[model samples]
Target: MSCMKTAENVCSTGIRIKDKKLTWKRSWQKYKYLYFLILPGLVYLIIFRYIPMYGLAIAFQDFTVFGGVFGSPFAGLKNFKTLMSNTLFWQAFVNTIRISGLKLIFAFPAPIVFALLLNEIFHPKYRRVVQTISYLPHFVSWVVLAGLLDVFINSSNGVLIMLLKSLKFNPPNIMTSNTWFVPMLIVTDIYKNVGYSSIVYLAAISSIDLGLYESAVIDGASRFRQVWHITIPSMLPIICILLIFNLGNILDGGFSQIFVLYNSLVYRTADIIDTYVYRVGIVSSDYSIGAAAQFFKSLIGMFLIIGANYTVRLFDQKGLW
Candidate 1:
């Protein structure tokens, strides 16, 4: 007891039971309003995000519906081995990477470029309108947009095909073609969220000291030169931060969009882990296998997030921690 007391005294700065309780009391008193506001979100994450973690144990079991989660006999390494040997699962994984890769290559940079261009516009009313129009799509649900996209890209009555036919050119309905899935993914993602994504960059740009721009203008720097020399460089830290955040999701294939837009016609290239999980798990009633696949996806996501944070720290010396 004496030795334990001595160690505790030496480490007194660390959180002890009484100290932690007092700290919580102080924090609660100081930020009661903020805590109140965050209570709902805290409950939400706990209910939707954290609580569902119990289902993950199915990945290790036979997980029959009749036997139930706890009643199911444990079958260690069985489901995981099956996942490893499955060709279709691998194909779906590859498609997810391809779609997400294209999104990063095209969708990410387009918003930054758009934000930069908008920042340069001198017309106030036009700028606000542009921002409003651009930001609007981010609020639209994929369920609605997928139906609209189907209508707009229908081979017979679609706008693009109609315009092309008017010019004596015939283009295939790209939505159902494997060859166009990648570009479609990029274009649709960019069109939907680029405006809202640019909000961060716009905020970063606004925070940059205006005096730098004034000095650049006095030196006769052209608008393009000013943006290239001052704006992008000033925005580098935030850009890197955003890039790191994006890199952490290199495998998420935007499940809702793909599920709504895709049919077997494009499954060769369009199918992703998420959609495959739905088909094989819910439709086929293979809960164990589905849980295994989900576990793998979560593992990959964790690695990507850690790797991205590490890369950002290496380049900029700051990370989420």
Candidate 2:
């Protein structure tokens, strides 16, 4: 009887395994084209992203170009200790948090507001024109934009400065001022990204059922009331998800933008982890310390992502998980 019972269990397990294999085979057949389409992206990630992750081992070593990763002497936590004690590293860390926080507060909402306003424009052609114009700045390289802004703000004959002078207001070079530099970064970041960011919100807006609006209309709801009550609620999940994503990247601090736009005069406020790493690691050839700093940042970012996702879930909302 025991042997018969064991035989029955094995047969059931085999059947389940067979079912799973058949289900997977059907799914593969259905999505084979989609998989093929994503193959190049997978290859790119494998080559450029995953492969390069092997260099992370340098964080644990006294890395030297002559010795290479495997040949370098294992220094354990010495590099991390050095990084933690560095005043410049701490300053960069603080600047990264402050800049990223300011951006989160101001720049994050700009796109949502812009999307709401853009949705109010009923004329399709005019809406398209505005969207095209807004998206233009996002496509412009930060290098080019930074150069243009430098000319517009730093040149003695800059139009902005010239206008201020003409009005009898002697405006100093705002870019160099620590107080003004961060604000400039925030404004420029919003200007560059708001349009592109709004595309996602607009998509969310489109996905909202029209019936909700119609019902609100039937209930004598004003457009603002309808939007506040219906559209905003519909977008909450997406907003939460994006907020979590942004929190995960809180340490990034817009490296490309800041690196190009900042000068020595504004380094006090503008220097961030990425720039610090570039200076210390690439320029100063302290590769081990830089790697340790980066590894630390990545570790913190991973925790932030997990925490953010957990918080989002706690609110009974969908999360990245």
Q: Which candidate is the best by lDDT?
A: 2
Total clashes, candidate 1? 0
Q: Quote the RMSD, in angstroms, for model 2.
A: 7.0
- Give candidates' CA RMSD values in order: 6.2, 7.0
Candidate 1 collision pairs = none
Taken over the whole model, the C-alpha lDDT of each candidate is 0.86, 0.89
Model 2 lDDT per residue over 1-321, tens place = 226545534544365455454465865875689799999999999989876577878999999999998899999999999999999899999999999999999999899989889999999899889988899889999998998887788748878888889899988888788888999999999999999999999899989899989989999999999889988888899899999989999999999999888888888888999999999988999999988988989989999999999999999998887
Q: What is the lDDT of candidate 2?
A: 0.89
Worst 10 residues of 2 by lDDT: 1-10
